[model samples]
Target chain A: MAVHQRQTVPQAADRLMPSGAAHHEQVVARQRRGRIWAIVFQAAMLAGIVALCALLLNILNQSFGYVAIVNTIDPAELAVDGVPLNELPKENLVEILEANISAGLMRRYEHDIPFAERSRENVHDLILERVVEPQVQATWGLFDSIFARDSVFAEADERFPGSDVYFRSWLTTSFISKSQSSEPLRAGVRTAIFGSLWVVAITILFSFPIGVGAAIYLEEYAHKERLLNRLIQTNINNLAGVPSIIYGMLGLAIFVRILELFTSGAFLGIGDQSTANGRTIISAGLTLGLLILPLIIINGQEAIRAVPNSLRQAGFGLGATHWQVIWHHVLPSAMPGVLTGTILAVSRAIGETAPLVVVGASTFIALDPSGPFSKFTVLPIQIYQWTSRPQDEFRNLAAAAILVLLILLLSLNASAVLLRNRFDRSRAIA
Target chain B: MSRSAPIAQAAISAESMQGPVAGAESTSESVLGGGPPLDLSRKPRVAESLIQGFLFLCGAISILTTLGIVYVLGRESLLFFANEEVNLLKFFGGTEWQPAIGRFGIWPLVTATFMASLIAMAVALPMGLCIAIYLSEYAPQRTRSVLKPILEVLAGIPTVVYGYFALTFMTPLLRGIFGRDIVEIYNTASAGIVIGILVIPLVSSMSEDALSAVPNALRQASYGLGATRLETAVRIVLPAALSGVAAAFIVAISRAIGETMIVAIAAGAGPNFTFSPFRAAETMTGHIVRISGGDLSYDSIDYNSIFAIGLLLFLLTLSLNVLSQWIVRRFREEYE
Candidate 1:
C-alpha cells in the first residue's frame, strides 16, 4: 500500500505540473477561442432576433403600400351635363349600373339592398363598383413608396400613365368590415374572421371540460400502478406529440364522411342544405379541439399535481368525502393554472392551419359563416390562399390578414403567459 | 406527515380526543354516530360512482383518438392499395406521382420531404444550439425575460403567416441572391428555410431547458479547474445534457417534416424526385393539402392516394416521437 501511494503521488504531481510557458500559452489560446465562440453564440441569438424582426418588417412592408388604380370606363364619361359620377342622381346612377353590368348581377345587387331604399351615394358607389371597375395596375412596397417616391411615380408614369396612385393601408377598418372580393382592390377579411371566431369558439367549448376532467382523473383518482392509468398516461403523451395534419385526416374521415349527417346538422333538421354535407364549422372546430385536447390534459395534470396535498387533507379532516374534498380544495387552487393551460391551448388552435387545410376549409369563401353548420374559411386559410395567387396585390391583402392573425394570437399568448406568472406569484405568497 | 390517513386511522385518532367520561367502546360508538352506527361497508351513491366513471372516460378519449386515426388510416390505405392503379410494389419502388398518368410511386414525394427536412435541420440545429447555450449559460435576467417572450411570440405566429413569408419575402430574396434562373419562385429552399425559422423557437426553448437542468456544481467544478465558461458549457454541461438535447433535435426534425402550409404554398405543386434544394418539389404534407384542398372527387385515386400518404406520414412521425420519448427515458441523467 505504501509503494502504491508513493507512486500515485509522483504521477499526480507530474500531471498537475506541466511545462510553464507551454501550459500558459495553451491556456491563453483556449481563452481566446472561448471569447470568440461566446461572441459567435451571442451572434446566433441575435440572428434569431434579427429573423423575427425581419419577418415582422416584411409583413409590415407589404401591408401598407401604394397602388396604381386604372378605371376601365372613366366616371367622367358617365357624367351628365358636366356633373361628376358621385354627383349624379340616384336613379341615374342605378340606371347606369343596370345598363353596364349583367342582368343577374344587377338583380343580385338590388336584392342585397333594394334600389329604391339605397341612398344616392350608395347607388353611385355601386355604379363605380360594378362598372367603372378601378383595377389596380401596379403595386409598390411601402419602403419604395416612402424612400423612392420619385422612382415610384416615374415607374407608374412609364407603365400606367392614366392610373392614379393612392397610398393605401390594407389593414383599415373597412378592410375588417368588408367581405372578400375577387378584385384585390376590394378584398377584406370579414368573412374569414367570422369563420375563425366560430371555429375557435367551438374548439374551446368542446375541449375545456373534457380536458379538465381528464386531468382530474389522472392526477386525483388514478393510482400510479394501475395498468389502465399507465396506458392512458402514455397514450396522452404520444397523442400530444402527433403531427396536427394527421388529426385533419381523422376529422375528414370521421366528422366529414362517417358522421356527415350529424356534423352537417341534418340530423338536427337545421342543416345548411347548400353545403349538403359535412365540411362545416363544427367539423373544423371538433378537429382542432381534438388536436389541442392532449395539450390541455397534460397542462392540467401538472397544475393539479402542483396543488399541496395538505389542502386536500384539510378538506378530508372535516369528514369531507373524496369528491367533496377535491371539489372544495383541489379544484379551486388549480383553476387558475387550468385556465392558463386552456388559454394557451386556445391560442395554439387559433393559429393552427395545416389541419384545417386537410379538413377542407374553403379557400375562396365569400360568405360569412352564420352557424356551426355553415361552410367556413378561416383567417389562416385566407392568407394561405391569397399568398398562392399570382397577383402581387393579393399578396398585400395576405400581409394585412397576417397582421390581424398575429394580433389575435399574440394577445392570447400574452394573456395566458401573464396569467401563468400571476398564478405562480399567488402560489408563492400562499 | 400523513397527508390523508385512511378513514380507520382517522377514527382511531378521533378516539384520543374523547373525554374521560367515555370508554373506548362508547368512544367508538360516538364516532360512528350511534343513531346509524356509521356503516363500515360504505356504498357509493349512483351519482358519485357515475361522476368518477365519467372522469375516467374523459381521460380515455385519447385512446379513442389514436384508435380512430389508426382505423381510418389503415382502412383507407387498404382500399387505396387495393385500387388497380396503385400497385403495392410500385408504390414503394417507382419515383413518379402523377395520378393522371396512373403513376403513384411515393419516392418523389418522399425524396422531396427528405430534402426539405434536411435543409431545415441544417438551419435549425446549429442556430438552435447556439441560442440555447447563450441563453442558458450567459444571458442576464433582463435579456432572458425579453428574449424568451419574443421567442414565444415568434413561435405563436401562425404557420400560414410563415408560408406567406416564404412565398413573398424569402423566395424573392433567394431569387435575387441566386439569380432568377437558378432559383424558382416556388422552390424548396425557401420553404425549408422558413420552416427552419418557424421551429427555431421550439428547438431553442427545449434545448435551453435541458441545458439549464444540468447541475451548477458541474460548472463550478470545471471553473475550479480553470476552464472558461464556453469550455464548461460545451465540454461539461452539454455532454451531461446530451440526451435531452438529442430529444429536442428529434422533435424539431419531426416538426419540420410535418410542416404543411409553408411547403404547400411555396415548395411548388408538382412532385419531382430531385436532390437539389434550389428546384421546385412537392413534399408529402404539401401533396396531401393540395389534393384535399381542391374539389377532389370522392373515392378517386387522388382522394385515396392522400390517405396512403397520410398513413405513411403518421407512421414516420409516430416512430420519431416514440424514439425521442425512448431516448429521454433510457438515457436521461438524473441530477441531484
Candidate 2:
C-alpha cells in the first residue's frame, strides 16, 4: 500500500525522471572511473610478474652462450708422436704433468693423490688442468649469442683473437658433477650442492619434530589464559619476525664461540678437532633451524586448527585418551598441511645466505661437506661469492648457480602447494 | 595437586582445575567443548603426561632463541662500547664509519639503511596496496590461484639471486636510463629497487588477507548506493582494513631494512653517507657481511661493532613487529 501511494504521488514522478537521467549519467561516469582504476590495479599486479620475469630472464640470459675459450697451451701442441694428451696412459699423462709444471707442484700433486692410484680419466683431467688450461677470455650471453651471432663472433675476434668462439652452455653436465675451480669454465657447484643438502638435512632434523611438538602443545594442551602459554605464543610470533641475521649472531656466539667443542665434534673425538673452530655445517644448520622454527610452529598450528573437532570428539567418545585422539585423528588429518608448511620452511632455509654467512659458510670450500662438522658452502653462498667478483665470466657462473638454486626452490615449493591442494581436496570430499 | 599446569603446578589430570575444555583449535564451523568433561578421578596416561611435557619444552625453545639473540647482541655491543677506541655517543654521532681509523660514527651506515629502505617503501607500499586490492576485489578465482604460487616463487627467490639481478640487470638498466657516469657501477638505486620487489609479495599477501577478512556487506552496501567497485575498494573496504594495511606497510619497511645481500652486493663498498640513490653506500647489513666475512679476531672492535649494529637491527625489527601487533589488536574492525 505504501509503495502504491508513493508511486501515485505527482512529486515522486518529478523526482524520478530527473534523478533517473542524472543517476544513469553518474553510473556511466563511475563505471568508467572504476574501469580505469581496475587497469591501474592490474598494472600494479603485473609489476610483480614483470619483476620476476625480468629477474629470471636476466639470469637465463647470462647462464648460457658463446665463450672465447683460450687454451694456455694448445692441445695440438701436447700431442707427442701421434698420441693425443688425453689418449696417453695415466703414467704418460703424469709424465706430461711433471714435465710441464714445477717438480715441487708435481710432488704436491703426488702427495695429494698418487699417480698409480689415480684413474686414467683423472690423470687426463689433471693434465688438462696443469697443461692445456682452456680459460674463458670473453663471453656473450644467451641473448647476444642467438640474436646477434655475427656481432658476438666479430667481438670475440676483435677482443680475443685466436680464442675458440665455441657455443657453451655454462650449466653443462660437468658443471653439476665437477668440484669448484678458480677457472670459471671448470668451477662447478658439486661441493656446494653437497653442503646445501647437509645443511638442509640438519635443518629439517632439528626443526620438524620440535616445531610440531610446539604446535601440539599450543593447540591441544595449553591453557588459553595461562601466562606461560601466552608468553610462548607471543615469543614465537616475535621470533618469526626477528631478523635472521640476529639468529646468525646468536649462532656465532652460542654455537661457534660458546659451544665450539660440541659443534666441532671435538667433544666426540671425531672430525679434525685441531683445525675446527666451530664454524661448520652444524652451526649453519642450527642457525637456520632456529630461523625457521617459528615459521614451522605457526604453520603447524594453522594445520592443527584445520582439523575438525568432531573427529576429536569421536575419539574421546570412544574413551580414547587425549594423546591417542591427537595421534590417530588430529595428527593424521593435519600431516599434509604440516608437511606443506615444513617444505616451505625448508625452501626458505635453503635459499637463505645471510645467517649462514654469519655462521661462516666458506665461499670457496672445495671439498664436499662430508659430515655435520665439515666446512660448507651452500649454493646461495657460492652464488654470492661468484657474483661479487668483478668479472663478467664469474657473473655467468653465478647465473648458472642461481638457475640451480631456483630449480631446487621451485620443486620444493611446488610440492608444498601440491600438498596443500591435496589436503584441501580431501577436506572438501570429507 | 596441580603442578605443571603453570610450570610449578603439578596436576595428575592437567585439566582437572580448569572448566569444560574449550579448545581454541576448533574451526568456526564446529564449536568445541560441547561434550561433558572427563571424569576427574580417571587414571592419567603416562605417555600423555610425558608428551605434554615434551611439547612444552619444545615451545620454550623459541623463548630461548630470543634470549640467546638478546644476550649475544647485548654482550657484544657492550664490549664494543667498552673499547677505548669506541664510545657510545661517538658511535651514534660520528658520520664517518671507517673503523680502521677509529672513527665509529654509525650515521653513514644508518642513513644509508634509512635511504635504501625509504626507496624500497616508496616502491613497495603503493604497489603492494594495489596488488592487495586487485587480488582481493577484482581477480577471478583462476587468476588468484595461478598468481598465488607465482608470488610464492617471487618471494622465495634467494636474496643473493636478487643481488645478482640488481648488480647485473638492474644496475645496467639504470645506467642506461640515467647515464653511466651519473650512476655508479654499484649504486643504492638498484639494490633498493630490488629489495622493494622482494618485499612486494610480503606486503601484498598480508594485505590481501586483511582485505579478504572484511565482511562482504560493506562492498554490497556500497554497490547498492551506486558506487563502482573501485570506489567501494577505496572508500569502504580499504578503510575497513586500514589498520591491517598499515601493519603490512610497517612490516614491509622492516623487512627491507633488514635485507642484506642485495644491498651488500649492489649498494657498493665503503660506508658512504650519501642521499643520492645513484651513488654507492653501505648499509649496516652490508657492512656486517663485509666485515665479518673476513677473519676478525673475536674481541676486536671491528668484530664487536657488527654486534652493535646487529643489536640495533634486532631492536628495530622487534619493536616494529610488536607495534604491528598492537595496531592490529587496537584498531581491527570486528565484523559479525
Name the candidate that leads on DockQ. 1
Cα lDDT tens digits for candidate 1, B4-108: 333334532322321111121222444542364454225445666788899999999999999999999998899999987788899999999998899989999
Flag regions of model 2 displaced more than 4 Å: A1-28, A80-98, A111-117, B1-45
- Model 1: DockQ vs. true structure: 0.47
Model 1 chain A poorest ten-residue lDDT run? A1-10
Candidate 1, which segments miss by more than 4 Å at Cα?
Answer: A1-16, A76-108, B1-27, B32-36
Estimate, for each residue in A363-405, the C-alpha lDDT of model 2 and write its tens digit.
6767777799998899999999999898889999999988899
DockQ of every candidate structure: 0.47, 0.41
Report, in order, each candidate's fnat.
Answer: 0.71, 0.71
Residue range A93-129, candidate 1, lDDT tens digits: 8878888889998888778988899898778767777
Angstrom error of the Cα, residue B251, model 1: value is: 0.9
Q: How much does each candidate deviate at the interface, measured as C-alpha RMSD after superposition?
A: 6.9, 6.2
Q: What is the TM-score of chain A in candidate 2?
A: 0.92
